[model samples]
Target: MHERMIIAGFGGQGVIMAGKLLCIAAMNENKYVSHIPSYGAEMRGGTANCSVVISDKEIGSPTVPKPTIAVVMNTPSLTKFEPMVKPGGLLIYNSSLIDQKPKRTDITVVDVKANDISEAEGSTRAANMAAIGKVLALKPEIASLESVIKALDVAISARNRKHNDINIKVLKAAFAQK
Candidate 1:
C-alpha cells in the first residue's frame, strides 16, 4: 500500500531532517519514495512542511493533497494539515507543543510527549528525533525498531550521538504507549 507522510514544525526542529531520514530509510528498503520540503519565509514560525511519499509504484507527483500520516510539532501546523489527512489515516501530535486535540474521528491520533521524552533522555533538541521514532514505529513502511536504531546509530554523526540516542528512546517510549 502507498503511504504519504508530512512532518511540519518550526525551523531548527529538524522537521526537514526527519523527513529526509524517512526517505533514506524507505530507499534503503528499496521502496519508491519522494521527499519535498518547503522553504523561504515558512521556515521560520509561519509554517515549515515536508512531505514524504512511499509506494510500490512510481510516484507520479510529490505533492500530496491527502496524506496518510502527519506529524505536527505545533498547533498551527496541526491545524493546517489536520484536514488534509484522509479518513483512517494517522496523525502523530507533539503534545509538548500542542494543547488542542484533533477533533476528527476518521483518523488515528497519537499524542506524544516528545519534548519530555527528549528532556528525560538528556537533550531538548532531540524532541524531533523522538517524534520521528513514533512515526517510524507506527508506519509499516519504516524499518523495524532495531533496524531504525541501527540506522540512526550509523546515520548520526559523532557530535550528534546524544541527540540520536534520546530520539530513539522517545520512539521506543511512544511505541510502548501505543
Candidate 2:
C-alpha cells in the first residue's frame, strides 16, 4: 500500500508533529516512509506543512505534488491544499476553524471538529493528534492506532512527555468517532 499525505495548518497547530508521528508510526510498522516539512520564517502563527509518504515498497521522492490524503487544520491550509488532492483521494478538514466546505466532488471529504474535540479532552493544542486519529480511523491501512500511540512516545521529547497522556486521549477519542 502507498499513501501520500500532506498535513497543513498554521505553525503552532502541530502540522509537522503530526507528520512526524505518522512517519514514526509507519516506521514502527516496518513500512518505508518519507517526511518533508516546510514552514514560514515567522514560525508559530505562520504557515506550516509537511509531506509524508508511507509505502510497502521504496519511495521515489519525498515531495508530494498531489497527495492521496490531505489533512487541513485551518482555512488557509484548506484553500491551498484542497485542489491539490488527487481525484478519488481523501480530504480531512478541521471544521472548528474552517467554515467553508470543500468544493471538489471527486474526492471524499471528512470534517472533524479537531479543536473542539481536543478542548473537550483537556487540551486544544492536541487538535493535530485528533486529526491524525481520524485519518487513521478512516484509513487504517496506512497505520494502526496502536502504532501511532507508540509513536507519541518516540516523537514527543522527555521534557514534553507530560502531555503524552492527554495526546493519547485525544487520539483515541478521535479514532472512536464513526
Candidate 3:
C-alpha cells in the first residue's frame, strides 16, 4: 500500500519529529519511506511541516503535491493543507487548537484532540505522537503500533529518552480513541 501523508503545524509542535517517527516506524516494518521537512523563518512559532511517503514499492519523489492523509495541528495548517488532500483521503485535525471545521465532503475527516490528550497523559509536547497514533489507528496499513513504539528508541535523542514513556502513553491513549 502507498500512503502519502502531510503533517503540518507551527514550530515547536513536533511536526517534523512526527514525520520522522513515522518514517522510522515504516522502515522498521521493512517498508519504503521518504520524509521531507520544511520550516518557516521563525523557529519557535513559525510554520513547520513535513511530507512522508510510505509504500511497499520504491518512491520516486519526496514531494507530496496531493497527500492521501493530512494531519493538521493548527488552524493555519488546516487552511493551507485541507484543500490539498486527494479525494477520498483522510484529514486528521487537532480539535484542541483548531476551532474551525473542515469543509471537505469528499474526504473523511477526523478531529483528534491531540493537545488535550497529550496534556492528560502528562506532556503537551507529545501531541504529535497522539496525532500519529490516531493516524495509525485509522490506517493500520501505514504502520503497526508496535513498530511505532519501537521507533521511539531511534527517533528520540538519548538525552530526551526519559520522556519516551509519556510519549508512548500519549500514543496509546490516542490509539484507543478509535
Candidate 4:
C-alpha cells in the first residue's frame, strides 16, 4: 500500500529519528520510500517536521503537501500539521505535549501520552519512538519489530546501551498499547 506521512515536533524531540525509523522500516519491507526533512530556525527549540512517502510505485514528488497521516510530537507540530492532513486521514499527537484537543472532524485524531509514557519507561527522550509505535500500530505494513530493533541498535550503537534498551522497550510497549 502507498501512504504519505508527516512526523513533526521540535528539535531534540527525536522527530527526525522517528522519521528515519519509518523510512528504514519501509526499506526493509521493500517499499519505495522517500524522506524529506523540513528545517528552519526553530530547529533547536523550534519546529521539526519530516515528510515520508511510501508507495508501491515510484514516488513522483518528494515533498508532501497533503499527507495521509501526521504524527505530531508537540503542540506546534499538532497545530501546524493538524490542519494540513487530508480528510479521513490519521493524526497521532503526543497528548502529553499537547493538551488542546484537535478540532478537525474530517480526520481521526489519536492522542496518546507519548512523553509521559516514555518517561515512565525510563527513556524520556524516546517520545519519538512512542510516536513511531503509535503510527506503526495504525499501519501494520511497517517493518517487523525485529527490524526496528536492529535499526535502533545501529542508530544508537553500543555506547548507549541502557538508553537504547529503554527506547526499545518503549517502542515495543507502545506497539502493544497501540
Candidate 5:
C-alpha cells in the first residue's frame, strides 16, 4: 500500500509540518515513510511543499515526481501541483483560497473548504490539519485517527502545544464533514 503525496501551500500555512505529521503517523503505525520538504527563499509568503511516501514495504526514495495525492492549500500551489498529480490520482484543494478548479477529469478532485472551516473554528492555521484529515478520510488505510493524534503531540513543539486541541478539533471536523 504505497502512497505518494504532495502537500503544498504558502510558507506560513504549515505545509511542511503537515507532511511531517503524516510521516510521524505512518511511522507510529509501523509503516515505512519518507518526507522531503522544499521551500522558497522568503519564509512567510513564499512557496512551500513537501513530498511524503508511505508504504508497508521499504521505500526506495523520498522524491515524488508524480504524486498519487496532491493537497494544495493555496491558489499558487493548486496551479503548480495540479498537473503533478498522476493519472487516476486524487487532488484535494482548499476551495476557500483557490478560485479555479482542476481541469483534469481522469483523476479524482475534492474541494475542501479548509480555510473557511478552520476560521470558523477560530484557528485559521488549523486548515493544514483539516486538509490532512480530508486525505486520511479518503484513504483510511493510510493512517488511523489515533495515530494522527499521537503524531500531533510529537510534531508540535512545547511552546505550540496549547493549540493541539484546536488542531484536533479541526481535524475531526473536517473528517466528519465529508
Candidate 6:
C-alpha cells in the first residue's frame, strides 16, 4: 500500500509539524516513509507545505508531483494544491479558512472545520491535529490512531507538551465525528 499526501498552509499553522507527525506514525507502523518540507522566509503567515509518502514497499523518492491526499488549511493553500490532487483522491480543507468549494468532481472533497473545532477544544493551534484526525478517519489504512497519539509524544516540543491533552481531545473528537 502507498499513500502520497501533501499538507499545505501558512507558516505557524503547523503544516510541517502535521506532516512530521504523519511520517512518524507511518514509521511507528514500520512503513517506509518520506517527508519533505518547503516554506517561505517569514516565520508566520508565509506559505508552508510538505510532501509525505508512506508505503509498504521501498520508497524511490521523497517528492510527490501528484498527491493522493491533499490537506489544505488556508485559501491560498487550497488554490495552490487543490489542482495537484489526483483524480479519485481525497482533498481535505479547512472550511473555516476557505470560503469556496473545490472545483473538482472526480476526487472526494472534505470540508473540515478544523480551526473551529480546535478553538472549541480550547486551543486553536491544534487545528492541524483535527485535520489529521479527519484524514485518519477517512483513510483508516493510512495509519493507526494509536500511532498518531504516540507520534505526538515524540514530534511535539518540550514547551508545547502541555497542550498534548487538548490536542488528543481534538483528535478524538474529530475521529468520533467522522
Q: What's the TM-score of every candidate structure?
A: 0.88, 0.95, 0.96, 0.91, 0.95, 0.95
Model 6 misplacement above 4 A: 39-46
Model 4 off-target regions past 4 Å?
41-45, 157-162
| Per-residue lDDT over 1-178 for candidate 2, one digit per residue giving the tens place of the 0 to 100 score | 9999999998789999899999999998999999998745523544689999999999999999899999999998898899999999999999999999999999999999999999999996999999999999999988999999988988988998899999999999999998
Clashes of each: 0, 0, 0, 1, 0, 0
Residue 96, model 2, lDDT: 94
How much does candidate 1 score in TM-score?
0.88
Compute the lDDT of residue 161 as modeled in candidate 4. Answer: 60
Evaluate model 6: give its lDDT.
Answer: 0.90
- The residue pairs that clash in candidate 1, if any, are none
- Per-residue C-alpha lDDT of model 5 across residues 1-178, encoded as one tens digit per residue: 9999999998789899999998999898999999988744533454688999999999998998899999999988887888889999999999989898899998999999999889888896899999988998999888987799889989998999999999998888888886
Residue pairs with clashing backbones, model 3: none
Model 5 TM-score relative to the real fold: 0.95
How many angstroms is residue 169 displaced in model 4 relative to the true structure, after the best TM-score fit? 0.5
RMSD in order of candidates: 2.1, 1.9, 1.9, 2.0, 1.9, 2.0
How well does candidate 4 score on lDDT at residue 53?
90
Residue 103 of model 2, lDDT score: 97
Q: In model 6, what is the error at residue 136, expressed in angstroms?
A: 0.5
Encode model 4's per-residue lDDT on 3-67: one tens digit a residue.
Answer: 89998888789887788877877787788889988866534555788889988788889888898
